[model samples]
Target: MGFTTPTPIQEQAIPIILSKSDLIGCAQTGTGKTAAFLLPLLHLLTEANAGTEEENPKIKALVLVPTRELAGQIDQAMEGFSYFTPVSNLAIYGGGDGAGFEREKMALTRGSDVVVATPGKMLQHLRMGYVDFSQLQFLILDEADRMLDMGFVEDIRQIISHCPKERQTLFFSATMPPKIRELAKEILVEPEEINIAISKPSEKITQAAFSVPTGLKVELIKYLLSVKSVPNCIIFCSTKKSTKDLERELNSLDIKATAMHSDLEQVDREKALLQFKSGEYTVLVATDIMARGIDIKGVALVINFEVPRDAEDYVHRIGRTARADSRGVAFTLVAPDEQRDLFKIESLIEMEIQKVAIPPEIGDSPPFDEGNRRRGGGGRGGSRGRGHNGRGGGNRGGGGGRGGRSGSGRGRKPAGNRR
Candidate 1:
């Protein structure tokens, strides 16, 4: 009865989600989003499960999240909230070693009440006749934007097609993007919507970007970690190779850091996460692929060792900090060539990121623009072909909707904002 007081997003979304109506919730991350959906799903299941036969209750709930980390995180939350009730659950993700999952199969196959799974791995079991979704009554798609961005549309469709169309549906994402909106129309009927988008970074986090030369990013990271106040931090790289290289450099510098990426074995990745969580490591450098579902607490800083390519990713990267009412900082190291991309990020999020002057000791230099001269270099240009100098021109090619609209060119703002 005493789940922490509702955040604004939760206050608005939970009731609607519990009312047996389809819902689209647009809210920034770290706002008790998991609870907003989990609470209602639990309320529904706890009643259905009470005094019911345990051996064959039939799977009543399914949560499909965008990443493996999120699937595990949500499954844990479900167990925590439903502790005293008859509800049971399982977390299924890809890349885990066979033995770890094999231990959990008994609980999973015993007709547990809820299943949290990643789309690809769940499909493997569904096709093999291991999981039957015929009686599934609730479907929650968490981090819907990232799912669409990562090309999960077909898998999502297949999963939905397998479920009962009359059941309640809940879709949550930090950003709506057009593709998510269209998908919502297809899956949800007469949906209630809630949007709590904080276009700016969280106040607890002091955000600033440094202009650095691409080659010197690792050096800059080394220097940042040298600072006395550097607490638990995550260094974000756009690719796996960079993550490994950076890990090597940090270890060489006597910094306790590890890389968490898809390349690692599932057990190794889980070990890395647990080590970072238990204070055995100070830094966890990772690629954006694992951004959405990691829920580590007390993360004092998030450093974008490599700036993200999309504004949504920038938000996801920064989300690791300022969680659960704790203040944190997110710093981005931007190279000169990436200035334009940073500008695009600003435009997409509708907020200005403060610029941090590089300390002379780092020797990071701004890159020369096409004009063959050094420039102040701020702000991503607009979609309408306007340069930083305010020169107006035609719209950029292949530009149509907010947050990369595709298909028919019609994109709806995330669920609740339309009101």
Candidate 2:
């Protein structure tokens, strides 16, 4: 592996992990948190398993994640990091055929050095009575908050019930909500805590939004893609229906785009993601499922066709771009009803995103008003603005004028040294 200076999370986390103590790590997406945990764990496993000649190698480490995509991503990264080493690993997730399940069963029974899995699939295997974790020494939960959000808390507990209680546990989450803290208390021992830029998007991302009417949001997206010629873009919608609808509209306009949602088969989802990553698809229209954990690099832009319901989700959605010291842009289209959601996001990010004026050809857009969100005002009555010239309007609504109030004042203090 090309070794260089570690990222902030890696620099702080790797040492703690190497100490063989439980740990709680809170960091934003794309901050090298995965490598932070993986590198140290791999080192320990390689050292422990050296010269071992047991007939049945028992599983030593387990990583539980929320999504299949993240499981596969971590599995690939594990392969690369352990390529020259003796460590063996496997990724277990649903949506595969019987042959895939049988392969996972073989690996689990024979004991891969490390096993990464989604909670449901892992629980399914655990119920079979053939999988054993008596020798497990490490238990890791990546995206703990996301798992809780997906209603996997009980499933996680069930999986943990099968593991050895004496094992070291690591909990990594992008956000440190109270629920996460509770879960951490139940799982991890006196673990060293590390929080790195929690709930903050990378500073390299150029953030802006267009206050378009709900009806004309698709037209504005078309204008941005066609006139501005944005390449490698990811447009996020709030629902699967919206994703499919927008994809259809973009395809109708001769734009090469694909849709990714939970309804699609796993193979189709993987193919769509591959096409997006390979530049065969110029744009990927997706729901919030693609917001976190799926790492596709070199994306030029992230567009939020609708505001996410949760403020923290906004951070993750924009985080798809501007990863790893690269510059990128994020845009949000705010409908009148979604103004409250926008205000919440601005409050969370601690800055009022610049409001780009809607193109006159796309018709007038509603004013940036959070108070009038309940009225559901349309674009017909708002003042006409100039075309897409990048001129931004003054701060409006509950954003507290320009830079919003600091989020530092709210939420519990991070349990460890803040970086």
- Assess each prediction's global lDDT (C-alpha) against the native: 0.72, 0.78
Distance from true position, residue 317, model 2, in Å?
0.5
**What lDDT score is found at residue 272 in candidate 1?**
92
Best by lDDT: 2
Query: Candidates' TM-scores?
Result: 0.85, 0.87
lDDT by residue for model 1 (1-419), tens: 45567887678777776666667777667878888888887786665444544445567778988878888788778777876665667777877667756644544455556788888877766666667666677888888888887788889888777776557777787766668777877777666777675555676778888888988888887877777366688889999999999899899989999889988887788889999999899999999965676788899989998778776678778888888778888888988767766766677555667887677888956842433112322333233211112111212222111110011111111111112
Task: Give the residue spans of candidate 1 off by over 4 A.
Answer: 1-3, 98-107, 367-419
Residue lDDT tens for model 2, 1-419: 65588987888888877777677787777988889999998888776666554444567778999998899899889888877665667788878588878877876776666789999999999999998777778889999989999999999989988876777787898777789888887777666777674555778999988988899998898888876566689999999999999999999999899999999978889999999998899999999889988888788899999998888889899999988868898999988778877776766665668988798989997888756533432322211121111211211112011111111111111111112
- Write out the backbone clash pairs for model 1: 343-380
